[model samples]
Target: MRTAVVFPGLMVCVALLAGCTATAPSRVRVDQAEGGLPNCKTFAWIPTPQQPATLTEQRVKTEVLAKLKEKGYSEAEKADCRVTYVLDVHERPKNKPSVGVGAGGGSGGIGGGIGVSLPIGKRNEQAGTFTIDIVDAAKNAQVWSGSLDATFAKAELNEDEAREIVAKVLERYPDRAPN
Candidate 1:
């Protein structure tokens, strides 16, 4: 009975430790004009001329559009509001050096141990910032913006992940009533 409990407890501890290695916490920030978002029911996506559209861009746009629609907003050729999004990724070296130490001892007779410490190669990390800006079409000025920053181990971005990130960021958007 004691063995069974001990084995299960050890497995639980190991599982908990494994889960602790998940991705780092992400940061989100939102800023809106004093009067809050416009009462417009329609909006359009405006692409930046400087940066050409990419796969990730297209995926995020689609996800955001769906989310907006779910909130009673529609897409129109010429609408009361314009939406533009930006995704920026930067690579930086993790200044912290990796160190490893190991020791082994002989089992029988006189036991002796040897230890070694070595510095491992530097690891590269990728950080990304996703921002969405909502502007008043007639005024040509931004009314609200939301951004999310996160550090990731993988350099490549996937559609599903982008969709999830965009959804989380857009959660800050104020809901609009049917118009």
Candidate 2:
């Protein structure tokens, strides 16, 4: 009897934790080592019209800047390397949890649940893909290119989450800087 009531609560906690531990962005496979990306840490942000419904061009810029700065990248019009990133987002899975009423409020049948509509199972998988390309002013071609995928709670509410995701995407640079 007691176990019956505690089991569901325990399960719900597990589901929420799983959602947060989903995935981190990825690194682009590039050739070369040493003398690739400069240590100046100069990066910029560029948004596309086809981006996710979660943010506006202005907000994305703000978020990206914050993320980069948080990672120790300074804001400058010019630096050793030119970094520009484009954001693309697509909607994947959106799961709504159908919670049946368990044993609650004296409504004793199977049980009762809360009125919240949050999904208990899988959620709508929203992805934020960033295309970061570094251009060498001396050479007209792109020197480095990287992409990152981030899953968000909702497609429309992306501003807050973008900071964390974009920062993570750029975090790869510290390790991937050409061998």
Best by TM-score: 1
Model 1 residue runs over 4 Å out of place are 1-24, 50-52, 98-119, 153-156
lDDT tens per residue, model 1, 64-130: 8999998888999898999988778888776543333223233332332334444467776888888
TM-score of candidate 2 versus the correct structure, residues matched by position: 0.47
Q: Name the runs in model 2 displaced over 4 angstroms.
A: 1-35, 39-56, 70-73, 95-125, 175-179
Q: For candidate 1, what is the total of clashing residue pairs?
A: 0
Specify the poorest-scoring 10-residue window by lDDT in model 2.
Answer: 100-109
Residue 10 CA error for candidate 1 (Å)? Answer: 32
| TM-score of model 1 (CA atoms) | 0.68
TM-score of each: 0.68, 0.47
